[model samples]
Structure formats: structure tokens, C-alpha cells
Target: MALRISKKYIHPPVSFLNNHFQFLEISEKITRSKIQSLLDEAYESRINNLSRSIGLAEEALSLSKESADKSFIGKSLSHLSLFHMIIGDFDLSINMANEAIENFEDLDDAKGIADAKYTIAGALYKTNDFSKGLTHLIDCLATYKKLEDYHNLARVQKSIGTIYEFFGDIKSATQSYEEAIDSGKKAGDLNLQSNAFNPLSGLYLNQNKIPKALAIIEESIVIKEKTEDIRGLAFALYGRGKVYTQTKQFEQAEQDFLQSIKIHEEMGEKLGWAMSHHKLGALYIKMNRLEEAREILVRALEYSNKNKIILIKFKANLLLHEIAKKEKNYELALKYLTQYVEEKESVINDRTAKVIEGYDVISKMQALELEANAQREKADIIEKKKIELDSFFYRISHDLKGPITSLMSLNYVAKLEVKDEAALKFLSEYDAQANRLNNILDGLLRLTKMSFNEDSKQEIDFEKIIYDCIASYKFLANYELVEFKINIDSKIVYEAEWALVNTIIQNLIENGIKYARIEDGNKPYISISINQEGDVIKITATDNGIGMDEKTIDNIFVMFFRANRKIEGTGLGLHILKRAIERLNGEISAKSKLGEGTTFTVVLPK
Candidate 1:
């Protein structure tokens, strides 16, 4: 049995983990006092080497039992439960967790009991024993709340919310999410806050609250990026992608799904990967990219089936059925449809969302109406708060940019005037800091401006725009050494919001030049291509620079995100580009591997 503990939800960073051989070397000299410590260390190995971790855990358990060390025995059982959960062994994990809970209960250890319950609930949730899982989770929540362990409380609330969402109880789910956000804020846990934000954003999206959903998801993405929570970020990005899909923003939807899938694959999170693939396939199908859709749907189906992820499998099969039907493959279509129907029915029956038809509901109409109004009022407050923050950013950015620019100019002049080497150096350093600050402010202005602009489509010279974008980047370092390849169809005439298009092209071109792995033996070059495809203009920017890993690529467009810490960047370039693309009703997607390089494709309405 694969005991899979989802890094998407339950991630306790193993700060104490090191090479397994180091622990093995130390264990040879271990005393009875070191037995429990060794067992604890064994659990940490699950992140690096699960099989060895499990073996060490089993050895420790046996040693503890032989030594008659009840404490070590209990801890080893608890540790084993978590390891099992991580490897997708739900039954064994649940059994071990329960046993650990009993032992902790006997010893009157509240924290230990809570930890065991948390693991048990997680395993039970994965096993589809929702009612029982909820019971354990509620108990865990109560214990955490009583202990004022806000982080764990937030985690439990998020888990509970997920269950309620699964059960189709939106009201309960919303309440749980709200509680989770509150608790996470109190705990200062960005991971919990971001995790809670994902489901909550989905709930809002389901209700057709697009702005609210985007706001919530954007906030979640920011927090996830800050915490470097790749799984959490992927989940949040998927939620945003869903919102984009709902609004018929296919381009943005495709980009989000692709980035999310890349991150999920890199993290080895099967569920996220399957779901993202499923979504991307659906998007491709909607876009009439039948072959691509079919290919992705197959991957989604295979992974979901192997992992026993029912919902993702059901969705993938449904899309596959559609693709087969579209291709006029009746037999294949029928087969896919049948499988989809079976999975759907199985899921529906298993979930069996509880619904009540009661006459008393009519009598409570007046109170229900009041509650609705109150909820709307609360929503309005949230909207207003977001607006205020946006306004603050816009105003502060505008106000600061002027003074900063002036200061930079003054510093530059001071450097020129200063004769002493020390004074000149100090001025240059001050000037550099000022320039950095000015760049940040400029990025903020660009971000805030994104919301202010409306679609102002005009005749766009496709070739000229690309040329201008590239020209602006020529002043940057290595511009002369780096080769520029332009492949624009000279006859192509596109119409778009010129400012937004310009921003998008400029940032992308600049980033390709800025982050290119220049030191590497590979010749640094940027490939720019633009062509008209019916009513759309396809533009691609390919770079032979230092490429990004999936994790870094997922966050490359996030505000203040920088993939390579060794490189200097405002992190605002890609973010501003995304905002610009969104404003222009265009889509931007990227593909990259660690060393190969990056390719960004932009599709805009013509």
C-alpha cells in the first residue's frame, strides 16, 4: 500500500533531516537514551529516502518494545503512522495512528494525542472515510484550539473545509475557511493562510464572484511564493485558472494550468499533476486543439487511475470521451463515456451530498433574507478593503517615483562632482540603491496601472512592436553579444491594446536577456516570432539563457519573484507582463527546464 501524505496539504518541513548515512553512523553508538532520538530521526528520512526511513522506523519500534520504553514505543508508532501516510498506506497508517493516539491518551499527552489524531484524520481523508475522518479532525481541531496552537488549528480547519467542500456543503465550507484564515493569520503561518485561501477562492468562483475569487487567489499566490510553498502555490494557481476558464479567458487559463502542472510534476504530487493535466486538456479541447487535448487527457487518466483519484479520473475520462466523439471515433468515445459515467456514478454515490426538503425552510425566509444581506455586506467590506489597498499602492508608487528619480539624478551628479575616491564610491553606492528603489516603484506603478487600463484596440504593426521591444532591451548588458532572431511575418497586421501589448513584449524580451545563463557555454540568444493565425496573433519569445526549474517557473510571474538568487532582478518584470497580457485579453505561457532555457508564448486577439 502506498502511504501518500499529500505535500499539497500536510507538509511539515523536516528541518532536522540530513543524510541517512550520518544517522546510521551515529546509531551504532546509540544508548537507550538515544533510541527515541534515532526513531525521530528515522521519520525525517521519509522526505529523502522512504524505504530506508520505514526500515529504520520499524527497527526503532522493535528496539523500543524490547527495551520496555513506552515513550519511545509510542513515538515510534506515531512516526511510523506519518511515514505510512506519506507513502499512501492509509490502512496501516490509520491503524498505527490510532494505536499511537491510544498510547498518548494513556500517558495523558495532549500534544501527542493531537498529533496522532491529525495523522489519522489525514489518512482517513485520503481513504475516503470522510465521516470518520471528520470526527478525528474535529477532535484534533478542539485539542489544537484549546492548546492555542493556531497553526495546527488552521490546518485542521482547512482540512475540515475541504471535507465540507467535498460533501457539497458550501456554507459549512465557507465557515471553516474563514476560521482557518483567522487562525492562520493569528499564527502568522503563510502556508496555512495560502492553503485556506485556495478552497475559499474555489468556493467564490463557484458562486460566479470573479473579482473576489481573483483577489483571494492572488493573495494566496503571493503568500505561497513568499513561503516557497510549491504545492500550495500550484493549488492556488489552479484555482485562478479555473476562474479564468469560467470567464472564458482561455489563454490565461492555459498558462495557469501549464505552470501548475509543471510545478506539480516537479514536486511529484500525483493528485495536483493529474488535476492540472485534466484542466489543461479541457482547455485544449475548448480551444479545438484536439490532438494535444487527447494526449494530455490520457496522461491525466493514467495518473489519476494509478493514484485512485476518483474526481480527476472522472473529469479526464469525460474529456477523453468528448475528444473521441469529436474525432468521430464512436467505439472509443463510447468506451470512454462508459468509464466516465461509471466513475461519476461511483463518486456521486460515495459522496451522497445530504440534502433536506423541509417545509420549515419557508418559515425561516425572513431570517434567511437577513443573513443574506449581512453576508453581502461583509463581502462588500472585503471588496472595499481590497480597493483601498490597490489605491494605496497606486498612490504611494506614483508619489514616491518622482522623489526617488530626483534623488537618483542628484546622486549621479554628486558622483560626477566628487573628486575623492571614497566620496565617489559612496555616491555611486547610494545611486545604485536609489536606482533599485526606483525600479521597484516603477514596477509597482506598472502593476497598479494594469487595473486602470481598459481594452483600447488599435491597428498594431506586429513587426514594429517586436522591433521596438527588442530595441528597448539593447541597452542592457550582453545585448551586443547575444544574438537576436526575429521571425515576424511582415504582412501581419494585428489590433490590440497597444500599451498592454508593448508592456508584455518589452518585459518578456528584457527578462530573456536579463536572466539568460550568459556564463554557460551555450550561446545566449533570443528568438522572437510573430504570425497571424486567423483572428489571433501568436508571438513567441524563446531564450537560450539559464533556464528555470519547474518550481521557479511556476512563480516567475509572481510579484517580487526571482528564480535565480544570484541574478539581480526586480521580480516585477514577469509579473507586470502577466498583468499586461491579462489586460489585453491575451495569454502568456512558458516552458523551461533547469539548464536548457525558457520559451514564452503569447497569444493575443487580432
Candidate 2:
């Protein structure tokens, strides 16, 4: 996110994710502790790993939000928030969601806000705050509806339906899921339909409608395959295996369960793998294959305990205890059951802790955003004040230029009309003084224009412009008969503000003329050159001049800082030149020897 955490970053599309499920795959390969940690990341949604494909996503999101990365912030922040949701940290999820919610206004990024809303609603649903969550969820639905984002809308509806199913609101749940399935069909999004089909199939299975449940789940597997939804396919396979187990179709049930396990192993979905093992254990028990059942159940218990997944632990505990009870190891059975309850309670306590943490995070982020917005407002006020002050100064100086120049020029013309020799000398001195006033006014006007000019940009030939400026000034420049040279290969072009460049060049030349040496025996010279190196273009104006001390050179760029007030007139040229060069994304620096020469070089991007 930007400072407000409400700016945008570009995000990877869901289509990018549609290709595979890395979370499940990582689960299969790593050690139990590592796999558990990865799940914690996925659940906490904070784990960043490359081998863990989901971490690839977090890395991308993080890159977008760092510093003022406006380009990708919108995408990353909300993605991280969704990560929080997937892991069940509802408060953190909500905090991220709310931060993302205002991104649409930062830019006209409706899709960004929509994604944030979706994440927010999901968090709310996860934490059992269904009412307010539904509002955001519904708002997201409406946004997606307008966008015609059928693929995403279907997912949201399906999630809502799943929650309803969890709450035992069968009718509403079925309708909502059905709507999602229908929407998915229209959108050609088989993933959403496959997701919706789970609850539908699960509902039927629980009611003992074996054939209907089997048919729906089989269809879900087909859709999951079509969509390349490996995770959904694995779950669907599990569902089908359960149906087979219940129907006493032992051979088909074994085939389905084993197939599910193979896929889970490949995908590294620990939860899926654990479920597969638990089911295998149950099926073995049914067959009175006690030894095989015990082996698989024990492994399942190990994974469940490591992951701190209470539900899995509970199921594994019941199976292990029953196995013990059947063996007449009553004490062992009781002990396993006791451990199961304890593990289950621990998982619940952890979830409760996360909920509290999430709330605090949300509150803190909201406060930070509010403060940042206040600072932004203050910054805007300061900028406005600066603009107004500059505008007033520019307007007054601009209005004075024409009259001042006219008056000075008239005095120059009157000097030429003087006839008497002594009077002519006096008039000529007056002319020089008037010309000084004219130079001052001209410099002032250029400074004012450079400060206030607001015009469109164009690609400029920097080399040509500098050469032409030198040519225009060559004759009028009243320096001693200095050896003036132009040493420039002028093919470089750059994006620039034209008037600004002209003013900059004009000022650099004027400064060169004003400072050039004037002595009977001294070599007085000024040279102009331009060069390009990669993306940068450089211009150098060199002069064998009566140069300033290092201290004066340092102060020269400051507005109205003159090395010699006796030289007369305004000292704003270098300041104006600096501003002009900066505006065109160029830089200027001076290298000089006081009794030898000065080289003023300007560098700009091409």
C-alpha cells in the first residue's frame, strides 16, 4: 500500500492462480513440522516461500507495497489481506481489506476496491460476523455484477453458501450454492461450480441419499478436472470414496481413497493427505484389518497433532481409541480420548487469540491511515501557499518588464541623437546605463517566466538548441576578442519543456559573457559543447574568465546572489537556469579555476 495503504499496485490475475495449487503440493514434500509451518503461513497467510508457490504470490504483493510503489500497491495489500482470510486471521484480514477499500478512490480502480471488499466479507464470514460481512459481500457482489465478473461473483456466492451450510440453514444454503453453480456455468468458471457442488453433495450424503450424492460428487470431479482445480478434485475424490465406503463397495472405495492419497501426496496438501489416511484407517477398520488401520491412523494422528488441527486430531483420536477399545486396552483408549479433547481445546484457544490480534491490527491500521491522511492534507496546504506566493511575484515582475525595457531602449536611442562631442560622450554613458537597466529587466522577465511557465512537453534536440543559442548570442556578446568555440556533436534528443530549455541556455551564455576575461594581453575565450552518454545528455559551457572564488561560486545559484554588486543589475539568471534544468529533469554543475576558466555542464536524460 502507499502511505495511506490505499494506493494501487498491479496484482496477478486469478487466472494465474487457476493453473495450480502450490499450498497442497508443499504439504506433500516437506517434513511434518515444515508442512505444518507452511499451513500456518497459508492460514496466517504470511508465509513467503519460493518452493511454497503461495509465497511467490506474497513476494509479488510485498514488492508492490514497499515504499511508494504506487504501481502495484493496490494489488499487493489486498492480496496479503486475503492471505490472512485464507488462514483465518479475520481481524488482520479485515484491516487489510479496509486499507484496500479506499484504493478505488486513490485511482479510479474499481476492481481493486472490489477485491478488497471480497476479502473483507470473507474475513467477516470466517470470524462468524456474518451480518456485516454479508453487507460487504453483497456490495462486492454488486460491484462484480456491474463489472460482469461472473467468475469471481460465483466464488463469493459459493463461500456464503458454504457458511450457511455450516450453520445448518439447509434451504438457504442450497439455494445460494445453486445460484453460484448456475453463475459459474454461465461464466464458464468450473472452479466455482465445483466448489458449490461440494456442499450440495455433502448435504445429500449426510441425509443418506447415496446415489444422488455420488452423482453430484462425480460431476464435481469432472468439473474440477476441467478447471484444473487439483485441490477440489482431491476433495471430490474423498467424497466419492466416502460414498463407496458407506455403500459396502469395498474395492471401489479402496481405489478412490488410494487415488485421492496419490494426488494429495503429489500436491503436498497435508490436510488432504491426513484425511486420506484417516479414511483409509476407517475403511480398514470396517474390513477388520486392525493392524493396517492402526498403522495408517497413527500416521494421520501424527500429522494432525503437528498441524494443531483440532478437527483432524478429534477424528484421529476417536479412531485410535476405538481401535484400543476393541483390543480391550481400555486405559489406552481413555488416554487417547483425553489427549484428543486437550488438542481440540488448544486449537480453539489459538483461533480465539488470533481473532483478538486481528481486531487490534485493524484498529491500529485505521488509526495510521487517518493520521497519514491528515498529514497529506497539511502537505497540500503548504503546496498551495507556495504556488500562490510564487504566482504573485511572477505576475508583478512580468507586468513591470515591458515598461522598464521601453524606457531603457528610448534612452539608448536618444544617445545616438546627441551632436556635441562632450554631450555625445555623456549621452553614450547614459545609453550604457540604460542598456544595463534593459539587461536587468530582460533577466528578470526570463527568471519570472521560467518560474511560472506551465506548458505542454515535447521531445527536443538538446544539441541543436544549444548550438542555435550560441549562434544567436555570438555577435551581441561584448566580451574581449575571446576565442569562442563550439565543440558539440549535436544529435541527442530528450523529452523537455522547450521554453524552459531556451531560458536555461540563454542564462548560461549570459553568465559566460558577464564573467569572461577583459585584458590587453590575456586570452579571453568561451566555448559551448554537448555530448550524450547512454540515457543522459550533457552540455558544457566553458569560459577563460575572471572567475569567482569558491565561496561566491557556491552562492551563485542562490537567487539574487551577486559576486560583485558593482557589476550591476539583477543576479537571478543562475537561479532561473537551475530551476529550468531541474524541471526538464536535468542537472547543472560548475568546475572552475579562478584565474583560468569555468566549465558549467548540464546533464539531462534522453
Candidate 3:
């Protein structure tokens, strides 16, 4: 007989605030301090005394509004939203979050807006609004990445992974979890790490990677224990119980589930406590302990019904139905089966309604598109304005370059003529400033040219272009200390605009070398790999260098974004690379860990 492993596990929404007590500076210090203290109390007692926590958050909100401090008001609303979600008041949570977002936006607070969105996303998840939840999560991910907030980034990534897993996109889910793990490690937050680990283990288990699943879940359990995260430990133990049940270690599975239940009951986590009881009952049924299974299943059913946990309620009824049949109680089996079917249909209907709601949104969007089609004249006018803007940039870039070049030439002559150390120093500074301006103008010119020019397609010589890129960077400091490893398939030749391809490859290599760590005993190396799979060309550039934090990686492709201040750069290399790839309808992504290294991957069509 095939092993039947239960896949129903509770993944609670992350309820912790990103910046709970870190309030912005306001004129009213006394009010601000009072609000902060109230929020601190709310967060501390959130689990143990939920009603008190809610009261404290409400008090903070009232105090914040009285102070007329928008930042404090937003923070208070965000905390209240989180507290609401913890108690399963999802609609209230979402309403509070939306209000918080409005307040944050009025102040142009990106972090505040993101924090509120994160809370909204969690609430949306509980409400089964996965589409909206995923959208909010993606937005939160971008803000967290740009802020280089690793702790929140990890949390967002894990949430994204869960959504992807729900959609049955295992590959994307796995990638998201892996990214979460990376960010969690970078943040040095063991609790965050365990959050990712638990879900990741479940994914592995789904794939029948039993040993791998067991190992990761155990690792999470250890971290949760060490961190004294009683809530997290309960979840971890519940997950481990599932793993043990799958492995046919029934006694170990029972023990883990019982411990999880004890913890959940102590913490007053009704949903988790009930879920653990249901799972333990299921295990008993598997072991043919019919009487034990029947007892626990009935208890689980009552708790689930009281909590309105529809999923668990239906599942427990089904288990009871099976136990009744085993005892040859036909009438009782029929009754339980009827309840199971009715409850299960209710769940299906709810999910169906949600799907229909999504379709309704799409239908509205299509109607909007049709309305937009009637405004072609306005679109044409906007296009013309865009063209004019491009022309202005192109002209200005050229216009500025001449003066910049002249300034540089004059500075060079002044350096040659000036004999005094002070005068030479002044000339050197002038020269550097001139060069920086020149580089900026050059970047502007390239950007404008990309906007106007047509693609000049040619067979890309990956090897020669890579070699040229490295040689051009030879003048950079510590260039001699870097090792370049290039690997390209001899049979692969991608047909694309040479300049675009070169731009992508060169910037990646330059970024690696420029940021290469020069500390004693550190051997910096750049590895470039290129290959073609079917119609897509894949290029990866990796470097063991002074890697970036999450924020830098997110903004790396933005115009004039500089990650390293010490390195002499135009801050336009990666931006140009991104633009060039976009021009070719290609995609680019980066992953990095501070003090470890970075890897850039580009996927382009042939």
C-alpha cells in the first residue's frame, strides 16, 4: 500500500511589526513616548493577553491622533492591524492596514506603507484572497529589498513561497524559500530562518525527499528551541510529527503531536491546538486504534466548529466516518459521511466563489481596456510627449559633453603648469569632478540612444566580448588580484544586438571586479558561465567579492544607483545593463549576501 501522508498544516500569518517601537521624530516628545510605551506593551502581551494588547494599541492610536503625528498614527494603525490578524479578525485587520497605508502615503513613508501592506497581505491570506494577497506581498518584497531589510525580506519571501506553493508552482515556491533562507541567514535571525526552514521541509516532503525533509525540519526545531520561540516550536513540532507519521514511526509521531498540542493549548492557540489534535487522530486511525481515533476526532471536530475552522471540521468528520465504518456502525458512518460531504462542499463553494471573483476582476479590466481603446488620440499625444522628452535628453547629453570635455582639458593643462602643491591639489580635484560629469553625460547619451535606436542584430561572440570587458577593467585598482573564470558552450551562438549583449556581460563582470574584496587572505574571483537551452540563452556571472545587502541589490538597476562609494564608477553600469536587456525583451536577476558574494543571471531569447 502507498503511504498516505497528510499535507494539511497550519501556516500562521506573521504578526510581528517591522518597526514596532522605532517611531519617527515628532515635535510632541511626551505624546510620542507615551504612544511608544503603549505599543511596546501591546506587542509584548500580544499572545498571552490578546484583548489587553488590542486595548493598548487602541490607546496608542488615540494618543497618536491627539498629537497630530501622522507617523505615529500610521505605526499605531499597523500594530492594531497585526493584533487584529492574530485574533482572526481579518476584515478588521485589512481595514486598519488600509487606513495605515493612507496615513503613511500622506507622509511619503515608504517603509510605513510597506509595513501596512505586509499586514494587509497576511489578512488577505486568511480571507482566501490569494491574488490580492500575492500582489501586496510582491509590493512589500520590493520595498523590503530596497530598504535592505533582511528580516522583513525573509518574512515576505516565505509568504510568497507559501502562496506559490498553493498555486502548485513548486519550482517558484522552492526558489522563493531558498531566497528566504539566504535573506534569513544574512539577517542573523534564527527565528526567521526557522520560519523558512519549516515550509521548505514540507516542500521537500511533498517531493518524497524524506531524509532531506526530516533533516531540515529537525534543524528548524533546534533553532526554535534555542531561541525559546514557544509558538514557533509548537509549529515545528507539529511539522516534525507529520514527517514521523510519513516515515511510519507512529510512536514518535504521536509524541511530537502531543507535545505540539500541549504547547498550543498553553499558548491559547486554538487553531493550532485543534489542528494538532486532528492530525494525531488521523495517525491513530492509520494505526487501527479506532477507539482512540474516534475520541480525538470528535474533540477535534467540536473545537474546529467552535473556532469556525471549516477545513479542519470537514477533515475530522471524514476521519470519524472511516472509524465508524471500521466498527460496522453503518448508520453512524452514514451520518458522519453526510456531515463530511456537506462541509467539504461548503469549502469547495467558497473557493469557487473566490475564483469567480478573480474572473470578475479580469472582466472589469478587459472592459477598462476596451474603454482605453476609444482614447487612442490621447495615447498618441502621450507618445509624442515621450518622444519629445527622449529628444530633449539626447540633445542635453550631447550639449553637456562638449563643456565637460573642455573643462577636463583645461584642468589637465592647469595640472601640468601648476608647480605649487596647493594649486596642484585644486587642479586634481577639478579634474576628478570634470571626469565624473563626463561619465554622467556619457551614461545619459547611452540611455537616450537606446531609447531611439533600432536593434542591430548580430551573432554575439560571448568569448571575445567577455575577454574585452576584462581587459578594459585592467586599469582598475586591485584588478591584478582578481581571477576571471569564463565557461561558454562551444556550440552555442546567440543572435542578438551585439551592443546590448556586450552591455549586459560587461557590466556584470565590471561590477564583480570593482567590488572585489581586497582584504588580506581573501582571493577574489569572477566566474562567468554562458549556455543556450532551446531558444533561450542563459548567462550567469558570479563573484566572490564584497557583496551587497538586499537594498543595494534591489536598487542596483535604478539610474545612478551606487552600491559601493569607494569604487570609482558612473553608477550607471547596471542600470544600462538592465535597459539593454529590456530592449531585447530579456530578463535579469541578482542574488547576493553581504560579505559573501553576488551572482547575476540573464535570460535572453535567440
The residue pairs that clash in candidate 3, if any, are: none
Descending-lDDT candidate ranking: 3, 1, 2
lDDT tens string, model 3, 435-469?
Answer: 88888888888877888977878888889999998
lDDT of each: 0.80, 0.72, 0.85
Candidate 1 vs 2: which has more TM-score: 1
- The candidate maximizing lDDT is 3
Deviating ranges (above 4 Å) for candidate 1? 1-69, 76-80, 83-87, 249-251, 353-606
Off by over 4 Å in 2: 1-268, 271-299, 302-330, 333-383, 402-445, 451-459, 474-477, 490-493
Error of 2 at 194 (Å): 14
CA lDDT of 233 in candidate 1?
A: 81
lDDT of 2 by residue, 1-606 (tens): 555443333555666555455754564344333433433454332222213445634565554444344424555567667765654455776887777666655887877788888888776655445555665666677678789888888977887675566455678688888999988998986677788887788788888998899999999889877766666777788888889899999888888888888877766556668878899899999988988899999988887667544456778888888899999999999998898778667755654554455445445645866897899999999879867766776677678768767876776677668678888887778777767666665666666566576878888766567667766766555544656687766566566788987887787777777777776577777788777788888888888888777887898888778877756547777888897888778899988777776889898886
TM-score of 1: 0.49
Clashes of 3: 0
lDDT accuracy of residue 558 in candidate 3: 84
